[model samples]
Target: MLNNSTTLVKGIGNEKAKDLEALGIYTVKDLIEYFPFRYEDYRPKEIQELKHEDRATLIGTVQSESTVRFFGKKKSKLSVRILVGNILLTAVFFNQHYLKPKLVVGETVTLTGKWDQHRLTITVSECKFGVLDSQGYDPVYSVGGNITVKGLKKMISSAMEQYGQIITEILPERFLTSYKLIERKLAIYKLHYPKSFEDAKHARRRMVYEEFLLFQLKMQALRKFHRENSGGTAIRIQKDDVELFISNLPFPLTIAQQRVVKEILRDMESPYRMNRLLQGDVGSGKTVVAAICLYAAVTASFQGALMVPTEILAEQHYHSLKGLLEPMNVTVELLTGSIKGKKRKDILARLQSGQVNVLIGTHALIQDEVVFEHLGLVITDEQHRFGVEQRRTLRNKGQNPDVLFMTATPIPRTLAISIFGDMDVSTIDEMPAGRKPIETYWAQHHMLQRVLGFVEKELKKGRQAYVICPLIEESEKLDVQNAIDVHTQLQQFFTTYQVGLMHGRLHPSEKEAVMKQFSANEVQILVSTTVVEVGVNVPNATIMVIYDAERFGLSQLHQLRGRVGRGDAQSYCILLADPKSDVGKERMKIMTETNDGFELSQRDLELRGPGDFFGSKQSGLPQFKVADMIHDFRALEVARNDAVELVTSEYFWTSPEYKSLVMFLEEEGVLAGEKMD
Candidate 1:
């Protein structure tokens, strides 16, 4: 019955059903579950307790008959004087002349509207004949497209009345009792028609927990399924050989890097596949750790593949890894979209014949033509840039190869668990021994001359500087510096130095050439957008200037700041902006105070929320109707723990207690390929 079409409701016709469909409501269950965005409190308030512009409900006796005055065209204003507790107040209504008969002198009336304390006026939005009901809260749904809020409320109420009892519970009785959660049917009722704010809170809590628990259960099942059905061939490499390879490196690994490498190697040696995320700050040597893992796989006569989001990153890794591994008789190959004809054919043939011990490329690595023989290790740099399907495709090329995802964006532990719960996470928290922290400063636009002077000084010392702008071209609505304008100005100002501009609009080859020039020190001052946020490493670049830094999020600013501070020289990141909002100012302040990407990411989550933290498209975070990943983090933790416990126990999906949960997961398509039995 709950799955019946919403047309079964009392007042909904085909057209009205179409309108409801705009809100993603087609079935009776969808209608009932469409929770209100907010609520309006219509409880009667004392006149003395009312503040200026307060939306309040008041009960009073009519002191005078309503007077109707004509306004513009069909518009009319109806005003009446009402007396309550020796105070007289004016209640005005617009185009409600029909209510004049009800507002008779000496009659009691209840009204809800915006109050003007100075004039003691209530601009009535709603009027009733009697005192307010005990249930004073009215749920406000976000409605549109010919469907008024009143109509949506009516349809939802009808759906709830007819099918509320048929709403099945996904959570078992034990969880409800243990967590002190209300019944699903009661929770749904309270969510749509709450008597008080507390009732709404309780109902929202139940829903949030339910959403989080189901999500976590899905994650746990994924993790379990990946582990059990890994089909991984354990690569046996001696610890002594791994130690020898690490010792052979020109630079010693940091303690954090060593620990993470150990974790990766252990997972690789196990029969179960390695599904791990390698999270590190900018220049924290994540690439080195990945290189070491690739070496381990290659030494065991297994091919390794590293996929990055961009061709520049792929090229960067190709050069670095070739330098590191070529001396050890390890063959490395690069495969990207730009590589074509004979060269591309040669690389593909080598990859299939297992001659290419390690292959690095962009999305080209996931193409159908790219095949690997004895492929044992798959590493994706900046993993969030690729979708889940893209990563799966690369992994599918090999039979359950150990997969390592690398990202410079430091996600907070809470978010990492929520988003990457299915994978084991490793963080390289420590920077290299001699690496200097990037000195960040926030300056107003008026101080551009001073910031430029500082950049000139750095350039005079034979260092490169990056000038970042939020926009590629001039935006009329936004008063922010653009890359093209900034580049032209910088070129004119610093005529002696080469100033190159790069943006997303530039062709891939053009962008790569500009990056190469900047990396080779041919370009002294590079004016670019956030295109330089990742993979462009120049040891000589020691200064970064970001115009309109307030336009960027905290994590983004942090990423832009990371463009510099790659070398031993003292690096500086100058943020130029006069932020209007307190949040923008806070973002600048936070950036200047610390260079910890993890700390900045946490603050970014707080300021921008999880949706905008990594961006919704790349975030891999689930969109929950009631549960906020940041605010309800504690509930998520609880849900994850409970999910892990349940999935690992004897009574998992096969048990009668979890029958509803299995059904729900299957319906949600979470168990699409899973063996339920």
Candidate 2:
């Protein structure tokens, strides 16, 4: 089996493996069992079911010879008339002059596609000629780069042909019998080339169970490790101190905010280390919950650190924390890559001397020079932006400071459980009273003038607007409008409006200046990329115009829409999309129909799948081989139960099979030999 694993019959080289690895396939184990994401059935249909306008797969014998017709300077198109008993249909292939010789007249062929008014368009996708008709489901392998549907099908067939019986059964026999799961050998065979729809269904079920079970087992192990090894940082919370801080707040706390603060306080009272995730929508008062935690730490004579994703977010957190905590004489210090000179030195000195009660910054907060004084609480805003190592680095700054990670991106409950398996999650679902949902619209390019007029009207009313483009500059691959070009165009067209440009390429200070000007209403219209997605909140801003809305994922469009509707007045989120494609129309429809982030996220997962939604850059969620995040949710739940049971059982660590699994996990960076410090 080991020998069979390394050698491919067609002989795959390092170059091919490297390309596969780029798509997250690293080992033979990953490739052989890589199941198809979806399937399309290509069974021949009866002539009675065939509509004039509908695309259908039909089986018939050609009655005459094929002929090619060419226009001047254009490649010829091949056309053939076929007869199936009483029905006659024309099969057409475009720009394929060479097909005339291969597909001779009077040959029986199976073709699939829609029939136009007169011509039946040939779909070159996996059609078989002179073969027995198939009447069931067909698998569609998720192909990428150089791997085409035809090529992948061939490779998979070859792999199965060579290593038919050599495949090892990884799961223990006893467990397999107990779960009623099929053998790994049978599962692999049917996954790639199933004999029937029932076989494929069973194969998918077994594979999904295996992936979910393994993933849940890993999380359960981590949870158990934390439960046993995590030494709770017990802080004596002065209820008076907490109440005093809350009382001094300029605005009253929302019920959700109050609930989260209470939960954090309870966690701080525990002797176990606090590993909590705070998830909230935009403007849901997460910053305030964080400040309450900081106050608790300070009142206990300990320090807390807040780390944000970007310098701008760090700055925003700093000011917000300062405004709330400074009144109580708690010193809030700001740190980032941008801070330098004497000011930086002074902040570090104060931090080391325990003068700074709370420090807020970007990744610079993880640097060796940034030492904390009695750091007891570590809070990371937008925790997904930081790597596991980076977050651990900051946490290790103190003796295993209680870690709290926050996210503005709202995820569904099932996703939260699977993704953040190790951390206790707290959600702030309710927005504060007086906040309004951003009225959203989906429009075409032709309506740009009307959208512009609306923006002008808002500006005339002393409000501000944000124009978001997906790209920073022009791209040959993507012809969408960009920030730089849009800025210039707006400046030329809306000559009276103060338009400012900001993107990722700008210097930190430059971006900050542009944001400040926009916040101060110096710039009535801010043209930027998603850089504005996280910062520069202005109550006066009532409009958010996102160009190329189809270019963005639903979650992203939701986040950009969150920029507006933060204030009291009615706000609008205008999504401008080129609605030519079905996907484009569906994406825009989701934006206009729903304001609930959770619903949108689920829809996004269903439409775009988990890969593009979590994205390559941030694959924080465990990649499952067979578990569909949207469809196989029940399997996920079952896996969750099994994981919890295994972890709680005494034999989990003692069992040899689990030991091997643990070692595998450790090597994958999902688990370490010991608990995280």
Candidate 3:
């Protein structure tokens, strides 16, 4: 079904097929899965029944039509007064000259849009001329690129009629029956053209479940494969060495940090190579716990490498670890892409000769030429920043090296287990002593004066502040200003203080310079993108202002808030968010109510999705077209349980029920770390 192209369907010629392919519909099965993004309730309503902001469809006869008022030659406004029974309903059209001629006196038409009760009018974005009745609950596909909505609907109808029966079901029938799931064929049919809201809801449930089930099954397969292949002779843990390193610390480890260290040590002592995830909130001292484990590996006559997402993070970790380890006679070195010429060769020689016991670097550590002498342990700091292949490549440098993955993403326990089932997870939930919870406030656009006044007050106290702008998608124009614009505006606002700007487009050296200036308090206010959301340590900064806070996920907002409250003085996190939606306001409300990273993460998963939780390129989650990790989380749990049971049962590999599923998972390439299917 997936192999056959859409060109085979009736009415879809080569030129039309090209348009369909642009919408990601290439095959017959692809056309079938191209479900509507939304279902418009075109069921006509009475004129008096329409409330403010009600997206209503009104069916009535055109009683009168105004002369076309031209704003431009192609752009004109027409006000049509439609009579529904005795009441007159207004329909306004903008730039639709073709519709003006069609709206003659005493002609029936259906129009749908948000109704303005005060004005008693509705904008006619979508309208259909009819003689009889209105179409109820119409499918609304995202149509563009020369294919009209009617044309796309006709193509879908043709494809379904010709090839719907041949569409193979990937889920096993036995498993579906056990779970009481809706049938695959029925779900697909109802998803595209459901008669009622309940039917659409059930169809969406089934499809979302199928998406999660396939992902979990592949992850389970990958987990099995990794355990089989990544196992090696374990390096014995040197307790005395770990203790000496821990004792050298200026501060004591929190109970959470100590517990996580023990878990890592235990995993490394096992015969199987350690594949563990170190999770903690910001300022949770997870790095120190990782340090202890790396020290243990070094003491056991094995070289260790720790790679971070950014050079700033790498430099921070290097200076931090070097200050602690070099005093103990452990040779620690930093290797990055910037290290070149004689300096790069010297570092490489030192690594090969085991002169550097603990090597910490950025992306350069994973390069093929940077070979190690006895690379027994590999650590990836901020694991999600690096892709799947990168982690595997770094691990392959050693003969089945022990892998320790670290993240400050503060994932909920259930989500962590569901997504990273391939690795054992250890979380540090407690923060170090002397840290304070950031004082959070939610404000609107009108409160800009008061919020900036607060920032000025803080700056006057000789402290610094961070201003972060929401990540704007290139395709979507953000209503609020961007980082550079905000920086420019704030410069004039805070003329007495120095302000700096940082964004993704800045060069590496330029970014380092800006960050260095900010850290040194030379720049009293630093305006940056989400790049400063993690691993940026400036204890002097006591204020964080996020513009358009509703545009970001709760987890990211929480991380940004964490930038402050690291110092002794009280810090403030002011959110300048004025969302046009109630849902967006609700997200901001959640941020004001909690400071717990775990709670925020769980709420974030519920409010949106894991895909939207971070940038698409950095989320580290498999791309599932239907499954939203936020709303369809129950499906993830169900899939995880079912996958566990299926692998334990005899039907995992040999049964006909699993054939199409296995093939589909293999085709999706969901698991890239040492390929499972």
Best by TM-score: 1
Residue 341's C-alpha lDDT in candidate 3? Answer: 97
Q: List candidate 3 stretches off by more than 4 Å.
A: 44-53, 57-135, 238-263, 270-276, 309-312, 319-356, 363-371, 383-393, 411-426, 441-533, 544-560, 574-593, 598-612, 616-625, 648-650, 665-677
* Candidate 2 structure quality by residue, lDDT tens digits, 327-442: 89999989998889999999999999999989999889999999887999999888877788998899889976788889889887778878778778899988887778888998
Candidate 2 — which pairs collide? 55-113, 55-114, 232-271, 232-272
Best by lDDT: 1
Worst 10 residues of 2 by lDDT: 1-10
For each candidate, how many residue pairs have backbone atoms clashing (under 3 Å)? Answer: 0, 4, 0
**Per-residue lDDT for 459-488 in model 1, tens only?**
999999999998999999988899999998
Clashing pairs in 3: none
Q: What value does the lDDT take at residue 555 in candidate 3?
A: 88
Candidate 2 stretches greater than 4 Å from native = 2-44, 49-181, 226-232, 239-255, 309-312, 327-329, 335-350, 362-369, 386-390, 412-419, 471-479, 488-497, 619-623, 655-677
lDDT score for residue 136 of model 2: 55
TM-score of each: 0.88, 0.81, 0.76
The better candidate by lDDT, 2 or 3, is 3
Off by over 4 Å in 1: 46-54, 60-129, 247-255, 322-356, 363-371, 386-393, 413-415, 616-621, 669-677
Q: Candidate 3's C-alpha lDDT?
A: 0.83
